[model samples]
Structure formats: structure tokens, C-alpha cells
Target: MTTTLPPTHRALVLDQIGQPLRVETRPRPQITPGTAILRVLTTGLLSYSREIYSGSRKYSLPTPSVPGNGAIGRIVAVGPDATTLQPGDLVFVDIYIRGRDDPTVAALSGVHDGHTVFSRRMMHSEWRDSTYAEYARFPLENCYALNEKRLLGSPSEGGLGYTVEDLLYLAVQLVPFGGLRAIGVDMCDRVIVSPATGAFGSTAVQVALAMGASVIAMGRNTETLEKVRGFFGAAYGEDRIQTVPITNNVEQEVAGLSRFGEADVFFDISPPEAAGSSHVKSAIMSLRHSGRACFMGGQREDLGIPTFYLMRRNLTVKGKWMYERGDVVKLIQMVEAGILKLGQEGGARTVGRFPLEKWQEALDVAAERAGPGERVVFNP
Candidate 1:
């Protein structure tokens, strides 16, 4: 499946931050000595992309960078000495950066000053050809095998039909599960999730349920809560899921869930409107001794957390970034195996669709809430 292509391909390129992505007939990226080329299948824009673009997230984006971190694609070309992959292999690639030989373990662990890859072989890209295009060039170690059939399935009932949204959501929800054996999550753990309607929240609930955790989902809309419940099969039966609408007094809601404070993990994806950074501080107060709370969204201001509470509880506060190459493969498996479900109303459906030519519109739709099961997708 080696891809022999024309000299150039269509891609969305950004010359600067806060600028529109221009569709250009740029030269297809060549395979670097250690890299391979992939024909784009689908790529996901997780919360990090927006953060990186705006300079608010932990990761940085150099000017003239491509915007996606994870994508599923088929191998088109392989660089010299790249024996692990071949032309026509389906794979999911990671977003980490690769640097010249480095001395620290953090380089392999994804900690480089701003955009360097973690390991000497681990690769990171400062926007070198992303999934928003027809083809991408990736380092050999950064790519993982993907099942072509599963990746190509339709979303209709009985099919995985996952979109970039599903993949991105999977990436976001699985961050806590990475890094080594027994990443500290188990089935039936007490879990609390916030900002229940957004794509991130929706994924959190799905992952918690899949992992066998009891979820207490928070949001300001009963309608949205009901929608979420329906997605999990509670609409026809008594809801195993619970919901708390955001009221004027969020502290009260926070206090109410404190009874379950001994929760093993609390996932926060709420915006300021539903639960602000203070909400996480409060969640820390309610956590069981040695419990962990993960913040999955951005906070505009410093969140005031009482040090005494953290010290006494020994709380572990983690802010998730994005998924790694291997995580994406497992997520695709979960979806294909019928462990995870997606859709617009009852199942996964597109909220909006934009051609590659309308890149800005796609970004806008992704940023705003258009409707239920709404996700803006780019079909190149």
C-alpha cells in the first residue's frame, strides 16, 4: 500500500495564531530519514489544540504549525531504516515531539521545554503536517497499528461509526490510564463528572461507565442531563446515572456530593458557568484520603484550594493533556468491540459538516454548542 502521489496535496495551514487556516496546495511532506507518511483517515481536535493555539494550554505551537495531535491513517511511504511499518498499514500516531539526542527521561515522558518529544526516539511535531490535510509525515516510533475495518465502520446501529470526535473523546478520557501498569483506574470506583453536556463531559461519563464507576454528572441543564442519561440507556429504565443542575449556589451542590467524597477519581470538565476552578478545590475537600481528582479543562484564574485540605487528604490533583499513540488504538478497539457507543441523538451523529475549504467555519462550530450530539467535522 505504498502511496505514490502527485507532487502536492491539499492542507490547512496556519501562518499565525488567531488567524484563519488557509487551504493551500502545498507539497506533500517527504519522509524524513526516520519518519513515515500517512494518508489521513480522520483526526481529532481535542481541548489541547484550542489551548495550544491560544497559548493557554500547557503545550506550545510554533508559528506555521499544523494543529492536530492524533490521527488515524494508512501508511503511504516509509523512510530508510524504518522497518517497523510498511506502505498501506493503518495506524494511529501520537502528538509528542522528537528532539536531537537528549539526556533526561522527561523527553520520552513528553516533558520538553515547550514542544520536544519525551524520548530520544519519541517524536513531537510543532505542527509539521497534521491530520487537517490529505497526508501527514510521522516519525516511525510515534505511529501505532489501527484496524482498517474498525476505523472505516459506519456509525449506524451495529457499527462503530466513530468520528474524530469519538477518537478525541477517547484520547481525553484515557489520559489517566496511561504511563504504566494499573494506571490507578478500576471498575465500580466512585466517580464524579462535571459539565456533563460538552463533548469532553460526554466522553468522561462514557469512560466512567465503561470502567464500572458510579457517576454523578453535573451541569446547569436538566434537558442536557436527560440527553446524557438517554445516551447511557437510562431513558427507558430508572436512571443509574444522577445529575445536578448548576444553581446560583454551586457550593451547595458541591456539599451535597460530599457524602460520596471518598470517590477514587473526580473528573472536572466544567466551565466557569457550571463549576469554576473553586469547584475543584471543593472536590479536593470531599475526596477520600489518598484520592485523586483530575481537572480536564482550562481555568482562567488561579483556583483557590485550601492547602490544609490537600495535606490532610493527600489528594492528587491531575490535569489531563491529550492521549498517546497506544491509547488511540485501544479506544478504537473499545468502540469496535461494542464497549463504547456514540451518536447525535441516540447514537453518534454529526452536528455539522464542513469541507476542508471551510476550515474556519469548522473551528467555530467545534468551539460553540450548536445542538445535541453536535460535533463539527471536516471531511477532506
Candidate 2:
């Protein structure tokens, strides 16, 4: 049932490419069958957005738009054609419309412009964008149902309900999940993740662990490495979770890792600016012969993964774009069923939260690499 509607709502509008986001009261979005309106609860701040907003992300074309990448919301209304989703339904906006087999899927909905990342949805266009706003009207193609009650320790099970904080972690998780899934991580695989300590790396580490693979978490910072180790060490034990401090000495780290075991897969979630640094070559150095390595959400413009390892070590390298709807659904089920634990380090992953008016602070924090497992959020 549709509830009483509101006329206007607040949003962090990005009118210029490099300028700070502006908070303004804009007209509320209208709902149509192919579209639905959500009362945006919380939107995540990705570290990559710092470069994205700074105009440093060479692959991203600038447009006047909202900067939010993903968010959590309750459906307030849906168009007549959108009978699959209803009012009061809780969900996370999974904003990638890529790799869909059906040609007729988004052709009529105006989701993608056939120009941006992977010829997929731009996600920040005026027609369809992020949730850094009080209200959002999104294509049904970008909406994924997240059943909170199904979560372990939910209010129904004498636990606090799945909070907006959970939504924050889930929002950035799609990239890591999609990347790992693309290479088809297996139970017997021993994985190595470079720069596995930030928001993106943290999610990648947790997903790899949950997939039942033995993981070697590598990071340059001792503090962040230990923090990451504590998270995985406690649950999977040190035997299954190995933490290594990265250095320019790739051969030494590669030799050191041999004591634990060889890595079958190398999942690289390093920041784009740091993409071609030591980690790219080091990841290849650590992989076992015929081992698979996949670049997860790294920028290709400045990234240079050396081809020497592929020719010499018999390595298989692959590129994964975004994600599929089935992947998001599977992740949600895993989290709800208690197979995956987000921010399992016994503290909130939130670095900070801001009201819509204080969005600039949130954006600044979102771009910085100041803390471990930190996630910036906007409550609109």
C-alpha cells in the first residue's frame, strides 16, 4: 500500500565535477512501474570516490549528478508496473546494470547510456543515481531485496535488528564479492589479498574467508595488518588466516609465504592510485604455478600489471567488471544465514556518519585512508 507522500526532500547534489557536494531541498522523486522510490536510510562512502570526485579517476566521465554509490532504504512507493516490490520493503540499491543476458531488460528503462564503465549504468545520472539523498527514485534493475528478519541476531531472534551500519558494509561488498566470484574461488584454494586492510580489502578478506579458502592477508602498515589479522585470526584461527607485512622485497615475501602454503588465487583490491605499485607484481609473484589472479575494481588507466609473470609462471589473469543480481542475492542470503560476518572484529566499521547537510565532511572522510575497516555514511 502506498503511504502519504511528501513533496520535497533533501539531497547532496553534485552540480560540478570537482566542487564539493551541495546540500539542497529538491523535489521528491516520482514512482513508475519500471521505477520505485526509496526512503534512503544510509549510503556508504567508498575510498575510491575520493579519486573519483577529484577527477583523478581517468575512466569515469564527469557529469552533473549525485555522488552516492549505494544505499539502504525502505520502499515508500512503486509504479504500477513494479508489482514485484512493494511499500515498506527493505532493500539495498545494487547499482550495476552490467552483463545482463536479456537485451530487452534495460533498453526501455533508460538505465544506461551505453558509454560509461563497461557500457553499463553510469549510476550517477539525473535519471538513475546514488542514495546520498532523503529520497531516491531508482530503476527496478538496480534494487536488490535484503531481508533483515532473516539475519542472525535480528530483533526476532533476540538480537538488535540489522542496523543501517550493516547496510553500509553491504553496499561496498558487491565489488569484492563479484571479483572473487568471477575467478570462481574454491574451497581448496589458498588466496593472497594485497592491501587487504581497508574498507574494500576488509570486505574482500571476509568474503574469501567465508568462502572456506585459506587466506594470506598482506598489508604494508603493521597497525592495519594486525587489526585485519585480529578480525580473521579469532574466527578462522591463525592457521587459516596468515598476515604478512608487504615490502619492496617481493621475492622474500613470496618465499616467506611458502612456509604457510602456496596461493591458488590472488585477489587484488588495492586502491586505483596504488594499483600498479608493488602489490600487482607481488601478487603475481606469490601465486602458485597455473594459479589464477583477478583484478577486483582496480582502474586500468594507470594500472600496469606486469606480463612477465604470466609468460614465465604459467599464470592466468582475468578482469572482472561489476556484478550480477544473482551474486548480490547470494551474498544477502549468506549474511542473513550467518555464514558471513561483516565487521567481525568486534567493533563498528563506521568511521563517521553525517546528516545530509554535513555531507562534505562525510565525503572528505570517505576519500581518506585514515582508519582500519572504516566506512563513511550519510543519513539522509
Candidate 3:
């Protein structure tokens, strides 16, 4: 927490393609006048690393890019103009996404010319040199002020008593909550969210219920369906929030749940693939003349929705992504206020933790079927 803090630290650096990241001592990242030096506490992996390295997402940075996105840490040094943060401040910083253009970070992150507007504020990060390190630098705008006392204290002392295992759940929940918010999912409107067992699907159910919508959750697992109904409450109950069992006849199931022919909003969070695409197409065919549907999962292939149906029905299609800075802050506050319960509300739960060295394993767990609720994580 001082200027004389060690000048070098270990970072998980990705030096090239098709290679595992290596831990190496690098010059400790410096805090600019409007930036902060963060000693990362935990960082969550986004599933985008492969695309980042392959140059598939055009938005990805060049090689040697750092491979982290979400992180929570403590501020150890603060530059001038970084008045909102001080030494020892517990914070959550998004490393993948660039901060809003501010002169202080431009030079540090190599956007010094100010000519690259998109690079200055884009969501891509230098995945080759990220938070997998002992310490990292963050732009003031990219950093968030967390409830330090509450986050780090004992549960007995009013801390949420949470662990890093809570990240995926938090992320999934934020997806629907933030995504629905992006398109205005209002209360009391009918809603149908499908594939309710996946993280995003479960999140859509809880988010819709929280926003006062009557959610119709669909999934193949009977137990997961029951769990969804129970958690949303019997008052908001299974009847109002029923789950349709997915099968060969997904279209029939969707048509059955959409009796009113359409809901206020429809969510498709399962992997975007053949079965998933058909379900969405069916939802569109059966959606009310003016309803909206959102695609909330990663794109697996091209979505070939019927243009005629969308055009004729006046249905809006939207693609959802990670939370925006403002939305992330709002969600963090919701968690602090006890409004969003990560594990209970359908976020991933930790079944194991490893040192930063096992980041690949952690990623595998996150990518696997991963049991019913297991989320493997790394603590730096």
C-alpha cells in the first residue's frame, strides 16, 4: 500500500498461440495519475480465450494478450486524481473491457495516441498479460468501489460470507438481470425462458421472477424444473412459473406453454445449436404479434431465424453480453443489499479451488457438465 511496493511481480503470461500460460516475473504494472494498482484477489475466466487467440473475434487483441476479464482485488497504490480509491480499498475491476477513455490509462495500456476510440473503450483486453498475476493495473473508470468491510469481514461481522465459487452464479444471474434490463423486461408480464438448467437459463428464470414477471421455465431435467419452481416461490408458484420438459418435440412444448401465443419476453440461453435454434424458431412462430426474444448464449453457429416471421410479427431480437459497467455496479449493490442470492438464484457454486497455476483445470470445470452445481475456481 505504498509507493515503494515491490516493483516486480509474477503474472500468468500467454506468450503465444497454442501454448499454456506461464508464470514469470514481470515489471509490476504501474498506477497512472488516474489509475490504481490492484493486487488481484480472484479473477474469473470468460469462455472467449480461444477466440481471442485465434483472431476469430476481430475484437481480440494481438498475441501475448492477457487472459483474464473479471477480477476482485485490493487497491495498493493510487495515482493523483484517483480520489475515489485509496490504499487498501477492496474493489472489483473488469480487465477484459477497456475503461472509458481517460488520459491516465491511455499511455499505460498503449492507446496513447487517442486515435483508437474503439480500443480505448472496447470490451477486449490484452489477454496475454492480465490479472493472472500477483498484481495488475486498472483504469479508475474500469474499477468499482466494493463494500470492503462487508466483502472481507466475517459473516458474523455481516459479511456475505461468500467465496470465489460464487463468481459463475453471480455472472449467470447478472446476464439475465442485466440482459432483460437492457431490453426492458417489466413486471407482471408473461415470460417464457427455456433451457432452464444451464447457468444463463436458470438466471433468466430468477431474474424474470424478481422483476415481477410470471416466468415459464423450460428444461429437460425434472429435478432442475422442480428446483426452479420452488425457488421462485409457490406464490409466484410452479403454476405461474411452470417448466416444460424438453424432448424431441420441443416445438410442441413451447407451443403448449405459450397459450397466450406470446409473452412479454422470451429468452434462449442454451448453447446456440441445432436443437436450441429450433426452440427459438418455434418461440418466434408462437410469440405474440409484438413480443421480443433475446439470444443470451454464446453463438455456436449462424442463427437462421425466419426473417418473414420476425418482420411480420414485429418481434425484436437481441443479443446479450456481459454486464455493462453501470449494470455490474448495480448488481454488486444488489448482492450487498441481499437482493441477489448467487448460489440459491442459479449461479455456479464452488466445488473446489486451486492456486492460480491450475487455471486451465478451473476452466475445464467451468466448461464441463460440471455436476449439478459445481464451479471450479482459482484464488490468486
Candidate 4:
């Protein structure tokens, strides 16, 4: 799938923080050793991206850097020893590309930084992390090739086999997928995804459901909740996937959700508006003894939990980062084996789209609470 390398291309550059992305024509990066170029197809507008744009989360990157972390595109050229990834291949641009390689680190410490996980940022170490451009360049390892008819049926089936958008949706799902794995979500667990039905919340709900756990989804909108409910069938009926709308008395029922059996995993991805003093309190109180809770994504206020509950409940609380190569591969395997279900077979839907030029509108929509089964994407 190799093609003639273009000299220049259009990109949405973040020259300054808290400012709108400006369209600019920049030099198309040339491929060096261990590198490849991706013609940006469509990148998702995740909540984190908006945070970076707003100058809230200070990334290690200095000013004038591209703000995107995840996207889906194709490799148009390859460098030395990078023969494994070819041109015209549909692949996912992982936001964080850090995984440890030093034998000593793996031998001594079981954990190592994986954006070491190639970030999808346009300016990662003098390389390109900006997928908002018409052309993006990155190390071969940062890109994971997507192939497998099972997960991606033939083109007409609303699968990745045809359009690149489906592949982007699959890539977006990896964020929560990685978090769930870190929290040890299993079939026997009762998972509660707070503020469910957004980019991360919706993805987590579906992944938990596929893993055989009963999901109690908490969201703010009834329409969005209904869309999540449509993802599954009678696999335990309504009891299997319970949707709760966020309200003043939300805690009354959230505390009772444990009645179906204590919650095993709680994903706190609640947005700012729905977040208040009660958010974390209800989440912690609802969990059973020794439950695992992950404060993954989303904005929340400083929450105070009773010290007695922390010590008595035997709860394991932790934070989640991004995914690894293994996580992405696991998602791919699930799709291929016909185990995971996406939009093609009636899962979620891409509700909004905007080209690179309309990044402002796209960012606004993505930042807004996404409607049920609706996700805003950037077609660069």
C-alpha cells in the first residue's frame, strides 16, 4: 500500500493553550529509521483531548504540540527494520506508547511505563503525535495493524472491513478495556460504571458485559441510558444491564444496587456537572468487601471517604492510565472470534463527524455529554 510521499499537508495545530485549533499547512514529515507515516483518517475527540486543549492537564510536552492521543490511520511509508507494518493497512494510533523493554526493569519491577506507550501526540520526542493533520508520523511500534474479518466483517456489514471509522471506534474502546483489566473485572463481578454512556463509560459497560459480569450503569440522561441497554439482549434481562440516571436522589438507588450482590468493580468516570459530594460517597458505600475501584478518567471534586469504610471494606482503590499492546490485541482477538459486538452487530453508533477544519465544533460536541450511542469523530 505504499504511495508517493506528499511534501505538505493540512493539520490542526495547537499553537497556544485555551485557544481554538488553527488550520495550517505544515511540512509532511519524512520517514526515518524505525518510523512510519500515517495519513490521518479519523481520530476520536475523547474527554482527555479536550482537557489538554483547555490547559487543565499539563502534559510533559511543551507548547506548540499536537493535542491528540489516539487516532486511526494507514501507514503510507516504512523505514528500515519496519517491514512488519505495510502501506494501506488500517491501524490504530495508540495515545500512550510506553512499554518497558529493559530486562532489568521487567525482572525487578513487575510494572513499567508503557507510553514509552507511543502517544498519538503530534510532537512526541521530536517525532509526530499530531494525528489531527492530514499526515502523521510515528514509530512502527506505536501503530497496531487491525486485521481479522471476524471483528471486521466484509465492508457492507457496518464493520471495519469497509470504512475506517469503525476501526476508530474499536481503538477508542481500548481505554476502558485496559482499565477493566487492571481492576481485575471478571464474569463473576458486578460492575458499576458511574456516569456511564460516554466515551469511556459506554465502552467500559460493554466490555464488562462481554466479560460475563452484570453491569449496573449510572448515567445522567435517560436517552443515553436506553442506548446502552440496547447493546445486549436477554443475557440476564434488565438485571444483567441496569441503567440508572443521575439525580438528586441517585444515591438512594446506587446504594441499593449492591443488593443484587455487592459490586465488585466501580469505574468513576463521572462528568463535572453530575459530580458532587455524593458521587464518590455512593460509589464507595455501594461496594462489597474487598471490591476493586478504579478512578480512571473524567473530572471529579476532592471526595472524602470515611476512614472506617476504607479500612473495613478491604477495598482496593487505584488509578488507571492507558492501554498496552497486549490490551489492543486482546480487543482485536475478541472482535475476530465473534465474542465482542460493536455497531455492525448493534452495539454503539458514531453520531457526529467533522473534518479537521471544523475541529472547534467537533471538540464542543465531543466535550458535551454524548447522546446515547453517539460519538463525535474527526475525519481529517
Give the top-scoring candidate (lDDT): 2
Candidate 4 lDDT over 1-380, as tens digits, reads 34888799887787777777688887887888877789888887764556667767543443465556467887898777786788878777775544234312110000112232343232334453457778887768778887735345675764445356666667657777888888889887888887676777777777788878888887767787777776553433566888656664646766556556678888876655544635466667788889988877545556555557778999898787655568888987787565675664535567778888887788777767454345678887
What does candidate 2's lDDT look like per residue over 248-326, in tens digits?
5767676767777668999887665565466667677777789999887454455656678788889988876556677
By TM-score: ranked, best first: 2, 4, 3, 1
| Per-residue accuracy of model 3 over 1-380 as CA lDDT, tens digit each | 36568888877666665567666777888766767888887765534343434344334333464456567777898878876778877776654244344432331121121226554343234312556678877667767777766754567998866654464355446667767777678877777787776656766777787677888777777787787677666534565686666664756866676665467777877653433345566666666778888877655677657779889988888886545666777778877776666553444566656676776766555566433344555567
lDDT of 1 by residue, 284-338 (tens): 5666788777765655566666678778878777765444445656665775676
TM-score of each: 0.78, 0.87, 0.80, 0.83
The regions of model 3 sitting more than 4 angstroms off are 1-3, 46-61, 96-128, 151-159, 164-169, 220-240, 248-250, 259-261, 272-276, 343-347, 369-373
Candidate lDDT values, in order: 0.59, 0.70, 0.63, 0.68
Worst 10 residues of 2 by lDDT: 104-113
Q: Extract clashing residue pairs from model 2.
A: 32-79, 33-81
Q: Residue 271 in candidate 2 has what lDDT?
A: 63
Best by TM-score: 2
* Residue-level error in angstroms, candidate 1, position 20: 3.1
- CA RMSD, predictions in order: 4.7, 3.6, 4.8, 5.0
